[model samples]
Target: MAVGSASYLELLLASDTDVADFDEPLTQARAKGAPADQLAELERERALALRVREILIGHRRHQAELQLLNDTAHDLAALHDLDAVLQAISDRARRLLDCDLAYISLSDRDRGDSYIKAASGNISGLLRALRLPSGAGVGGMVARTGAPYSVLSYHEDKSIIHTAEIDRTVRAEKMVSLLGVPVVLGRHVIGVLLAAHREQRTFSGRDVNALSMLAAHAAVAIDNSRLLGEARAAADELRVANATTRSHAEDLERSAAVHERLTRLVLDGKGVEDVVQAAANSVAAGAWCW
Candidate 1:
């Protein structure tokens, strides 16, 4: 029995299978009439194997998250449109969190509210266009606090200030659990990113961490997109300014050429007719005449 148990343990270690393999070995050991002590040891081994499997799974998940972040950064850099960038952020977040829905709310300081900028997964138009006033709703709380907020049941959670429009949208969408994190730049909360489930579910610490990481990435990407837009606009303005300068320089050069030609005519003892004709031709060719 001891030999059999030992061999089984060895087999488990050698195999690529996960904790599911534990059941088969334990059953076989029992059929082999293994002693109680042996069975206890086997149970311990099973627990250890499960823990190892969990660690491996967590490592793989972290790797996947990093890859997703990298891909998102590349997409953000390549995408020029703000809508496209927001859409990419929403899609990546939803896929990474495996949530029923994910969306972003951009802060509007002038209006003192947050408006939906992007959304993914099963969602209605009303929910997509939903707005949350500052200091209202879970998203607004995150915006105000600059932290991550989660609720097992949004309607049941009274701690968060609820607005009629947000409540109506949540009810219409049938969302049970919601998580929101601030998309902050420095100390300022720029926007909020939310992931919601249709069924009641508790968000684990890891879940919150992953969502927060994604939010951080999104915030930087959004800022970069805005900066890129401003840079393009500034470049266009500079181009226009440069063109105007060039036009003025050309006018001055033509004026100086005309003056020199008139002086040369005077020095050559030419008549007023020659100067008049030259000035007319020069004006027609290069300078504007009023």
Candidate 2:
């Protein structure tokens, strides 16, 4: 069947011509005699063509999405501010995943707490005040495990403990479902990416996969932004140091000029005692002595 389809497809492709040239010969062939075999062949060709068309359409759609994703990644990477990148990531995730809330939390290693760095939706104000201890919540678990996690029912999940403080915030914000993925950079787990729905919703595998991809991208962007910030800071320090060194050099040059002038005055018959007193004053004030 495959071989026959291939042959018929080849014939059909051969029959394809410019619309202007699609005249007598092709019409007569179709009208006078399309045998059962030829008709079958035509049907096979049509089916193959339809499949190819669908495949092409799917491929194009995928390419367009990829391009869009790449563009977004590039834009995010161009942002050197950590807060800006986090905000962009959260906003994009909320929009793309169609979630009610999105947020990013960074681990406060010293205090053993996770604090929300950026969030979307109505909970932004509340999330800003929420904090979770290490190993306390799902987001914390993801941070500790460096893996992605989800809870369909935040209140019902035994593995997820809801602290009274956090529960009040959650209830006030009307959050029901939760998804969290760790942001890993090298061997370090930097933070967590979270998405929540106000209603009970099962996050599909595809949704998890997409969030994982976004997390990976966000991790790199965050890391790069940090590195860039450090680089800029180092550069600013170096520039300041250079300027200070130059200022010192100029001061030394001026001091040397003053010494030359004083020595010339003394050599040209000024009073030695008076010249000495003047030179002492200049030297005390950062001028060179003769």
Candidate 3:
């Protein structure tokens, strides 16, 4: 029993072993004419080992999620371009979930639609710049609602309002399963991050939660990029305004000096030709008086 228990522990610790693999030692003991009660004891031990494996796997998954969040925060701090940020996000989501592809779609308020901005695992590139109306499909609906949603069949799912372009693109790519989470800011949904599969598959709750967390990070990046652009634009406008103000001030000073010089000539008993010549010179030199 001691040796068998140790072997069970070893099997549980093996990274590649599964629940079916845990039966090796018990099978061997049974072949050696082990008593019924002893076999039952081994069965109980196997059940315990499987439970331990579940807990261990779950803990590791949780740790990975925390690490991914930290990495995304680092990306936001280190990268400036929106395309770079979004590509990193989509790549990470695709790799983490083991999905066939992952992509990002941002809402365009002027056009009242969402368009794919970045993608990973997209071999054909047909969907890279595809446009979807605000309520046209899964990604668009998520953008409108600011919620996470998943579907097993993108083509057959009646819940999604399929548009001609979106449906055609998806069908051409043979995409089946999809999950989308909104990139939200305060009360508005600004975009969506999505994962897809080429075949029908259900998204687990954990998958939904994981994508939601990633979408939250994406939202932060989008908001930061927009704010930075707005700040730069405002700074540029302020610079132009300041330059124009300085130019007008210099013009006013020149006009005042020309007026004072002409007035002094009149008070000093100078001829009108001298004042007129001075006025002409000032006018020629771009002086203005009102």
Candidate 4:
């Protein structure tokens, strides 16, 4: 059990690549017949060093997760195209959760189901065209519950109401594990953000929280896009109304000018030919006068 205490101290101050430097020295010391007391103390130091390494790695991982979420928020804020925003969220989820594929499924209250809206890293059309009825699959459960759901092995899981179509599609995509979080807008669950793997993988609480944060971002993006579309439609209507009003105003002004010209000709005792000529000058050739 002999281990290098010096290497243990170095481990605490070392970079990730440098942490592996302890094992070789530790093996050499064990073979050299080091005294039992010294070996025990070195073992204690080695355990402490390992614990420190674990904490350091965990902290770095958490930091990276926060950065990913912050980057997602910035991206959503800058992006106006709904499809691009959705794809960005899905792609970021795959990278953040270290999963093989990620997708966003939107709830259709009208249809009483949730349908795939966007996906990343998916090769099969099955996943792209997937539509899960409410309470049928992991996504559907999340849609109904408005809570996050994680599965270590989806097909084998009996906790959810798995439908044949969803099961068949999941099998075709070769998805083993899954995680879904509700994309909530106000009091309603508008959609679900998901991450999946082809191989069995555990979803940690941290992973769930990260995906949930991104789901919140997705909700805001959807709401903002909806508002923007509405504003554009209203503006278009306003422009059309303004154009119509301008056309009517121009017609009224021309009619008033024609009337004034005819009155002046009558006061000057102009002939019927002069009056007809003045009317023709003010109106288009095909326009009739009574």
* Candidate-wise lDDT, in order: 0.83, 0.76, 0.87, 0.85
Give the total clashing residue pairs for model 3. 0
Off by over 4 Å in 4: 1-3, 12-29, 271-283, 286-290
- Model 1 Cα shift for residue 244 (angstroms): 1.1
Alpha carbon deviation, residue 241, candidate 3 (Å): 1.2
Q: 1-290, model 3: which lDDT tens digit per residue?
A: 78689998898778898778888989999999999989999989988888999999988988887787788778767988988988999988997777999999988889988789989888665798598887888997687677888888988889889988898888867789999998888888888999999998888888888888888888888888989999999999999999999998998899989989999999999999999999999988788655
lDDT of 1 by residue, 1-290 (tens): 46545655565456476456667777878998888988888777777766766776788888998888788888788877778887888899888888999999999889888899888985677877787888888898898888899999999999999878889889888899999988988889999999999999888787788788778877877788779888999999999999999988888887887888889998999999998998888877866323
RMSD of each candidate?
A: 3.3, 9.4, 1.8, 2.9
Query: Which prediction has the highest lDDT against the true structure?
Result: 3
lDDT of 3: 0.87
**Model 2 C-alpha lDDT per residue in residues 121-227, reported as the tens digit of each score:** 85446778888877767787798788889998888888876688777777887989999888888998888888999999988775676677778877888778778
Clashing pairs in 4: none
Question: Which residue pairs come into collision in candidate 3?
Answer: none
- Candidate 1, superposed: residue stretches over 4 Å from native: 1-39, 74-77, 273-290
**Model 4 error, position 278 (Å):** 4.4
lDDT tens per residue, model 4, 202-282: 999999999988898899899999899999999999999999999777777767767887999999999999998878876
Pairs of colliding residues, candidate 2: none
